[model samples]
Target: MIELQFSPEVANARATGSPLVALESTIITHGMPYPQNVETARAVEAEIRAAGAVPATIAVIDGQILVGLTEDQLEALGQTTDVAKLSRADLAVCVASGGTGATTVAATMIVAHLAGIRVFATGGIGGVHRGWETSLDISADLLELAQTPVTVVAAGAKAILDIPATLEVLETNGVPVIAVGQDDMPAFWSRSSGLRAPLRLDTGAEIARAADTRLALGLPGGQLVANPIPEDAEIPRDVIEPVIAEALSLAQTQGVSGKDVTPFLLDRVFHATEGASLAANIALVLNNARLGAAIAIATTT
Candidate 1:
């Protein structure tokens, strides 16, 4: 049997049958710099707690899959260099080989299910990358959502992806994309994507009800709750579109492709926007955390 470990807080939460939300660790190790990453991780966890749920930040450390992390562990993971960027393909390998790694969305969902936690919150989901026709590079997050039973709350697919194609793939996979409080799907940094969402939910209770209904009807997969960024915090689509185009152009000129494309474009956009994009990212993540916690509470009760 695979030995899984939980931090003291998470263990207690699980024992008492309290609501819990799983968080991915890639934002701490791979998405940002040391102190800010650590700070953001703590803030997101606190958001969940304040909303009446426990936070379980998933990671693989020294062959153990951690369902939650202490402050020191969080700090150590943020400061450590060259930690593996783990997804569905390598999660088991990291555990078996005693490797240290941060869980991406796909890996996080798997771990969350194993821990019996049914909800997760993140800044955004990975999706069909631009130029996927030739490169055929798609994120495992899409497929994971189609199979994993956990409910994921996010702003939406990362703004850097081809949103329409991502929606098409989700539809093809029979995954439901439900926008919260809006008719249009959300872009990561923006409140609306201009494309109609497959469904719209007005409240966390409604989202929780949908999840329960899916299980009652024997649905095969989980749902994607596309929570929009807070209106005051958004960068607005009109302002961000040209910026994204410019960033993508620069990334191609720099010969950045495959996994490197996302980080490269994000960095360029961060610089171009004078750090507004990062601020927007942080806001959306916290917003999702609050909503995720509410859904977890409702689902468990």
Candidate 2:
């Protein structure tokens, strides 16, 4: 059996049959700098708690799968360097090697299902890279969603990805892409990606029902809840599009490829936008937390 550790808060929630939302830890270890990353993490957790759900932040440390982290663990993880960004490809290896790591969307979904938690909140899900035709650089997250039953709430695919190709993969895999509150799928920092969503859900209850219906039908995969960045926090598609292009160009010129491409692009965009991108990322994460909490509540009840 795999070793699993649950924080006190999460333990109590499970004991009492309370709603719980799963959160990925890469946002803390790999998304940004120390204090800000932990602060944003705490804030997102607070949002879930305030919305009447418990937050279980998943990670791996010293061969143990942590379904939720304690305050000290969170603080230490935020300050730790050289943490592996784990996905389906290396999650078990990291555990067996007794290495420290932060869970990516795919890893989080796997852990969430193992912990009996049905909903996960994230900043964005990784998907097909821009040149996927050649590189075949698709994220393991897409396949994870198609295999796990956990409902994921996110701002949508990272803005640096090819949204069209990502959508095609999701459709081909029979994953439902439900845009919340709009017909257009969200594009990470932007509210609209200029692509029509496969389905639009107006409320958390609607999303919850869809997830439940999928299970009732014995569907093999989960649903993607494309929650948009709040209007007040969005950078707007028009403004962010050019910035994304510049970042992509810089990545290409720098010869950044494979897993390194995303962080490189995101960092370049963060600099180009004078930190507005980070602010938008934080906002969208909190927004997703709220929706994930709502879905958790709906799913459990």
Candidate 3:
């Protein structure tokens, strides 16, 4: 049996039956640059704690699956070069090879479930990528959500993806896509995708109860809570859509594909928006962290 390495704070939380929220580590290792990456990670954790839950930032280091990260570990991870970007496919391989890896949404959900964590917070999820009809490139995150029992709070699938198709896939998989306080599905970095949500819930308690009902019914998976970015922080759909189109055009011209697609497109979007996208990303992540904590607390009580 594989043993999970829990940080002191997370260990204490688990021991005391306190609420815990799982955080993915790719935001630190791959989502942003070093100092900012570490800083944002700390800020997100702070948000979770302030909202009344302990944050467990999941990663794999030297063959151990760390359910939570210590401060030193978080800093080191942010600065580490050549860290493998792990997902469901590569996670076990990374651990078996004694390699360090940063967990993506799918890997984080898997780890969170293993750690008995019921909720995870992330900036956004991977979904059906554009040109998927040709490339057939879909994220393992969708499948993870269909099988793992940990509820995930994300702004939505990244706006760069085929949002409608992503929603369709989730529906086909029987995963609940719950929009928080809105009828419109949120796009990452933007408050509205313009697509109506399949399910809508107004509060953390509502979302938690839905998740519990699914488990009670022996449903295979968890719910996707599509929380919108704070209004002040959102880029506005009209503003971001054109920027995303230009970025997608550039990606096509450059032949970026597979696992490299998202980071490449995000980099282009970041530059095109003059770093506004990153700022919005940070905002949304913090927002999601707060909601995740709320859901965690709700699940326990």
Top candidate (lDDT): 3
| True-structure lDDT of candidate 1 | 0.92
On residues 198-287, what C-alpha lDDT tens digit does candidate 1 reach at each position?
A: 999988888898988888889877889999999999999999989999998887788888768888888889999999999999999999
TM-score against truth, every candidate: 0.98, 0.98, 0.99
* Candidate 3: tens digits of C-alpha lDDT, residues 1-301: 8899999999999999999999999999899998999999999999999999999999999999998889899989999999999999999899999999999999999889888999999999999999999999999999999999989999999999999999999999999999999999999998899999999999999999998888899999889999999999999999989998999998899988899999999999999999999999999999999999999999953
RMSD score of candidate 2 (Å): 0.9
Q: What are the per-model C-alpha RMSD values against the true structure?
A: 1.0, 0.9, 0.8
lDDT of 2 at 161: 95
Candidate 2 structure quality by residue, lDDT tens digits, 216-276: 9999989999999999999988998899899888888888898799999999999999999
| Candidate 2 displacement at residue 90 in angstroms | 0.5
After superposing candidate 2 on the true structure, give the runs of residues whose Cα lies further than 4 Å from its correct spot.
none
lDDT of 3 at 273: 93
Candidate 1 — worst ten consecutive residues by lDDT sum?
251-260
Worst 10 residues of 3 by lDDT: 292-301
After superposing candidate 1 on the true structure, give the runs of residues whose Cα lies further than 4 Å from its correct spot. none
Q: Compared to the true structure, candidate 3 yields what TM-score?
A: 0.99
Model 2: weakest 10-residue lDDT segment is 292-301
